[model samples]
Target: MASVLWFRRDLRINDNPLLSEFRQDIVLPVFIFDTQILNKLSKDDKRVSFIFYSVMKLKNDLKAIGLDLAIFYGEPLEVFEKISSICHIDEILACGDNDFYAKSRDEKISQSYKLISFNDAFLLPASYGLKKDGTPYRVFTPFYKSVLPFVEILSQNQYKIKSAKLVDFDYKSIQLESFGFEKADISHIPYIDKPMELLNDFKPYFDMYKDLRDDISKKPYTSGLGIHLRFGTIGIRECIRELILYQKEGIDTSEFIRELIWREFWNMLLIHFPKSEFDNFYAVDIKWENDKDKFHSWCEGKTGVPIIDAAMRELNATGFMHNRLRMIVSSFLTKDLLIDWRWGERYFAMKLLDYEASSNIGSWQWASSTGADGVPYFRVFNPYLQTKKFDKDGVYIKRWVSEYKDIPSGKLYDENYLLMYGDSFYKKPIVVHKVASERFVRAYKDGMIK
Candidate 1:
């Protein structure tokens, strides 16, 4: 009987536990273009394009080993049923996904097949990293401290491919049009062929990451590997192993590793409190203004605040935003605009190429001050001050907001100077920062009291 390797988030050939499990057996590797998820996306979603490219790459690699990837476009259950009808599948092996939809889908699939899943997405399995009472940790500091000591780095597996009984079915790649999506122009997007190449490129900047990560002007200061991690093109353990190697070479990896741990923190939170995906973890009974016009302005990068506008424009054009800007823009949306964080979260879910549900929701809740360990409600990010501090020379602002290219750096942060540009040059600031901050603080305090 042949085994079925069901590829979900884990797309790469190396560091794949599911692929390693059936190294010597007849493994039918399959990737389903899930309609349940795809139906919600636009026709030109870059994330879909990236995924399609990755699956094609995986198919080519399998062909080199005298194997073929079985690609399908439909619901997971229906796709699996078709696979079962075609061959005598012994069991289904896959890397487990912890999102709400995945959990539900896997539960239904398990009822029909012997689905064996592994924790390939995170460094620590969902079961590990717990509190003293065997419950999940809501706070991140304690969770990180507790799990740090128990972290074990695994060596990369080298699988021995063996010929086995081949199924008599056509194994070919599926067309994007067949799944109701068109070819997205992703030429501007940076994609790595191998995970090791990405790690190698980041080596030169690894030491300075702690110092320059917060500087928005230095655009690529942080390792640009979020999409790879989100899609599991690179395994978390493999990344940790490289970090360990870097530490041995006398470079401090604590800050970079902490960022990785933050990803795990979100994963743990989502696994324990799945409701946090859609609802506020710590519910506050405050009425959101939900200004439709304000949201449209923010989405269109017409917030009038240079930094916020730059960040939003960057996200709109590239499907990627700088981390510091993400925090600032999110703060501006929830604090200044007084819009519900869910609206901003939903927009990001649709736009971000590297959007992971757990991290995106976690970050939104944190920015909105509604999560278990979120920032204080009154702590609003002042967009002007943030620009002066991070993008002092206005390089990032000029790069994204072309209208402000000729403006002097000093004048960019000055409201009076910006007034000279008038509405034609840029839209006036939607809400006065100080006034909005006071309003939000007062409302938040009253809600907490109630």
Candidate 2:
């Protein structure tokens, strides 16, 4: 039977269920640059360039194995239909995607062809962990505990690719520009081609991760694996294996693994509650100020709060923000600026090279106190205090906000001082932290009452 190996998020050849489990007589490996999604993205989107690079690398790797990856530029349905017209396709195998657009697209394609999907993107399927009554767990800790046992079982790699004849097809090479995206400068980004290298680089710092993971100033702070994991350049099982290996070496990896489980929790939450992408999960009726100028300032990293400015500038420049910085900036946007979390979430979607819909949406909701197991509305992060805590030496701030280099680090932590200094070099604080925090909490309480 002729089967098409449709590559989506899972871009790698190693540890891929789609490649290892296939037993068809004839197989066509394919990757599509979905124009439907691409059209909505900016021409200079860093993710497009990264994906293009990864896809090309995958193509070459497949060719080395006496197989070729066919590249297509169109919607999945139309592309599949085109492939179906040429050959008698028995089935198309791909890694399952739980995002709304992916689900809808796959459903449409399944109507016309036999489409089979595997859970290669994540360690476990979204439906794995549930409460006693069969309802999905809303809280994370219980969910993490429930799924923790299965890590061993899931980690066990057991698969071999059966010999299959490569389907002969006229494949075409496509450039990043052909898809209407400018070639992005991805050299500064880590592990675009080699995920294992990044993993190796992260090992030395893994010991300090428990204590310093939240410190934005610590270079190589968190495992720089988010982008690799997001695109399936590295498999979740492979990462789990590394963690387990560390655990066997008597290195405490539980805290790091917990963060991975949090990623899982967010994915599961998104699968069950897709509407939370746009609406509040808990239905808090927050009447967001959504000041256009304030949001623009926040996006441009001109929030007058040193930490917020630094983090925002980092994200805008590099398509990456530290986890702690994400939390701080998100709080500043949602609570401090009284802007809609959706606004900030959407902006991240546009910029972050590691942007995963589930994680991004889940995190934004959490920051805004509109999600299950989210931070309380009363717990607004004081940007100044956060700076004093995470970036005490002002290393991160100085690195990103170059204008603040000559200024004393202490002044950055003082909102009144920055405000008094005025708009000479940097922007003044758009909203006072004390006043904004109280107003936000009051608004949230009012939302609950209504």
Candidate 3:
């Protein structure tokens, strides 16, 4: 009997549960560039380049073990059907994705083959955590406290690759041009070829993460593991293992562990409440203004507010933005501009290199105050105050928004001051922050579900 090992988002060979799970005499390891997803992305999408790079690496890694990775381009079902005609398929082993498109694709594939999915992308599956009432935990603190033991246990867990004879099918070669995609310039992105280097480099400063993480000027204070984790280039378990090792070495890793668990929290919540992907988790009807012109300004980094413009510009240029900046800009878009969080979420999905659907959706909802464990609507972030606290010297601001380099750091924080003394190239603030925030809070109070 032959088993097909399908590599989807879990692109790594190390600590891969699929490699260890297959017990069939013959194993066909394959990767399909699903046209369904690629059709929606732009031709110059950086993520496609990154995935292509990782898949080639996986192919080489598998070949080192006397196995080859078969490459195909088509719809998944059609690709699998072609595979079945060649090999007597017993089961398809893969790491499952919980997103809407993935769940539907997996369900459809299960009708024809025994599709066995393993939770290798995340530390634990959605079913691992529950309150006393047997429902999922909505709040992060309670969920973290409840699942801490499982994370500890799972961190130490390791996997060994089992052997299987390679199915001698014609291993096809695929290139970026074959998929009609041009190579994206990912020169600015660090650790593309090796994600572990970033983690190892961050180890010495793990203790300072909690204190300096929010400061935008301290760029290296944050770990750039998001894209690696997003692609499963580095397994979640391996990350936690490293974290545990650091803790044993007398370094405080509690803050870093908490951030990792936040990623898990978003993943679990998405699985439990799938509708939260497109709808508000809480039953609140928000009357969003959703001005396209204003959204365009925000997208183009013409928002007049220094912090918001700087963050948006950074994301546009490099496909990355600091975590603190993400929260600030998201809140500004949803609350101050009164745009729908969905609009902001979709925009981020289009632009962010490290975009995870669960985290993006959950975070956008949280910023808009329309999600479980969401910030209260009344707590709107003042962009000026945020700039003062996080980018006090305007170093980060000046790095992204060149027009603001001549303006005083203190003037960048004040909207009125910028209008008075800033460069002519800078646009006027879209709306009065105090007025817009108060309006949103009142509107939220009025429209909330009783």
Leading candidate by TM-score: 3
Write model 1 residue lDDT over 1-450, tens digit each, in one string.
678888888887776777667643667888888999998999899989989988898889877767778898889999988887878778898888788889999999999988898888887777765787999998889998988875643334333444554455789668888877898887765555665688867787888889889987865787778888888888787788888888899877888988888998998899989999888788685678999999999998997889888999989988999899999999999888888999999999999988988899999999988886787787899888898899889998999888887778887788666655637676677777889988888767766734
Provide the TM-score for each candidate, comma-separated.
0.95, 0.97, 0.98
Worst 10 residues of 3 by lDDT: 419-428
Clashing residue pairs in candidate 3 are: none
Between candidates 1 and 2, the one scoring higher on TM-score is 2
**Candidate 2 lDDT, 87-204, residue by residue in tens:** 8788889999878899999999889888898987788776685787889999998999999999868977744555577887877788888767899899988867678787666777
lDDT for 60 (candidate 1): 91
Q: List the candidate numbers ranked by TM-score, top first.
A: 3, 2, 1
Which residue runs does candidate 2 get wrong by more than 4 Å? Answer: none
Worst 10 residues of 2 by lDDT: 155-164
Clashes of 3: 0
Off by over 4 Å in 1: 22-24, 154-165, 419-421
lDDT of 3 at 127: 78
The runs of at least 3 residues in candidate 3 whose Cα sits more than 4 Å from the true structure, single-residue gaps closed, are 421-425
